[model samples]
Target: MQLQKKSKKISAIAQNKNLSIQFSLDGFSFCITDLTTNDVNLFSEYIFEKTIASPELLLEKIMYIFANDKDLQQDFKSVSAIHQNNLATIVPNDFFDRNNLVPYLKYSVKTLATDFITYDNLSSINANTVYIPYVNINNYLFQNFGEFEYMHHASVLIDKLITKIKNSSIKTGFFVNVAPNLMDIIIIENDKLSMYNSFSYSCKEDFIYYILFTAEQLQMNPEEFQLTFLGKIESDSDLYKITYNYIRNINFIESTTCFFNEDDDFSNHSNYILLS
Candidate 1:
């Protein structure tokens, strides 16, 4: 019998205590920062682009490079992978057996963030059976893989949103904006979550209808909650205009908790740019 040989190159950095890493396998770029850190370190950053035959190999190889760090060695809790199709997997340990993983996972999508899968939105997605909505829409209308992370980018954003939701302790009334292509929203409240709706439209009117439809499902009104928008810009396109245009007259205010970063320069498109 022959074994499959891994084919890949890797790079890594030991993030400062104040900085964590945000890597997009699709974009081939990684950004590190800690929101609570000092202003100087927060502003200074690094980024790079490269490809790997397998994204997991890139992570294992990079972790090997950072093996000297005691914190990464000890506190390493979980490993999760998100896929371009917006599906994700959460692994308990990096070295766990592979054959045991598939049956346990009914759906398979690659991951963006390496560890830290225990957070909110991801945890919900990880815990439940995610049903992908496949309608007869023409996929070719959009750019072919313009910047879709095979797994990790959206996972990272979901993780941050989950963290924000968990920490804020705000319940019963908040809106979350999401990208049209990714997974559907899972409303988190009182540490429990349930699927809200699924969509594939980039137009605000489409989203408004969807939201209204969701509200109808939940037996609520569109004017009752605050609105939060995600993925406002895709690389160079200003999508927020369309997003805001739909909700402009509503009394609901926008929430910054979903807008994790203020830096507009990050490569919002081209998921292939994420560094492995």
Candidate 2:
């Protein structure tokens, strides 16, 4: 990555910290790691009171974060950004064609001529993630960091989960990453990705409905298939309670208390994309 320093006065360490930021419709979170120590020196998130309406407004929110968050306004040896949105689709590697990006996402998500479509080749899952990223946000990062790397959040979440279960004793199960209004469901069978899909819900009914509906389509019995929960959910939450009511073998997957050198308390399941 090329370094783009915003200030000459900033120390060389400004060029040392590797920065990673994940953006969502609801908010964005970032982490900076030291080059020499490999320690996460800073980690924080800015969640909007409600989900923003447009990419333009989302860019404004990111601008506010960069303006206010001093640690983020520095140079970096490397910068990686993750775009989290529902506008993505997974195409099996065998059927994936670079020129078919627009066609791949058009049916699942609304697109426009101005939309810049890109993809991540998820070799692990033998799939390619085709989706649209926030061009304005990428431009801002280019202006600040000169060159950086990015991918759809699904690429991170799905690829990681697929690689993970393939190594474990687990064969067939349901892994769900539950966010405030969204969830990622990965159904694995015989150590292969049977299905992976994300859904948005306003109520518990909507949430379980999508999960059970997907399982029924796959002929997965809820009473038997194991369900492991991750992301911003607690056992006490209504989301957890409702899921447990329907699924018999349900539990939260255990993760370390912290990944940073400092005790910046974060759950294992919370930032599985960024922290892990």
TM-score for all predictions? 0.42, 0.89
**Which parts of model 2 are misplaced by more than 4 Å?**
1-15, 260-265
Question: Model 2: how large is the Cα RMSD against the reference?
Answer: 5.6
lDDT of 1 by residue, 1-276 (tens): 111221111223224322233322222122332233422122111122333334454444344433433333322122222332343444433333443443333445333333222212245335322212111111210132122222344454445455556767567433443443332444555544444433556455665566667656776554455555443234234344554444442222223322123443432222211221
**Model 2 TM-score (2 dp):** 0.89
| Model 2 lDDT-worst window of ten | 1-10
Candidate 2 lDDT over 1-276, as tens digits, reads 111122111133434679989988787888777778766666677667887899998888888778876877777889999998888988998888898688998888889998899999988878888989999999999998899999998899887777777778887868888877888888878767788788989999999899899989988888898899888887888988998888999877655335532333455567778767
Backbone collision count in every prediction?
29, 0
Residue 207 alpha-carbon offset, candidate 1, angstroms: 3.4
Q: Compared to the true structure, candidate 1 yields what TM-score? A: 0.42
Which 10-residue span in candidate 1 carries the lowest summed lDDT?
A: 133-142
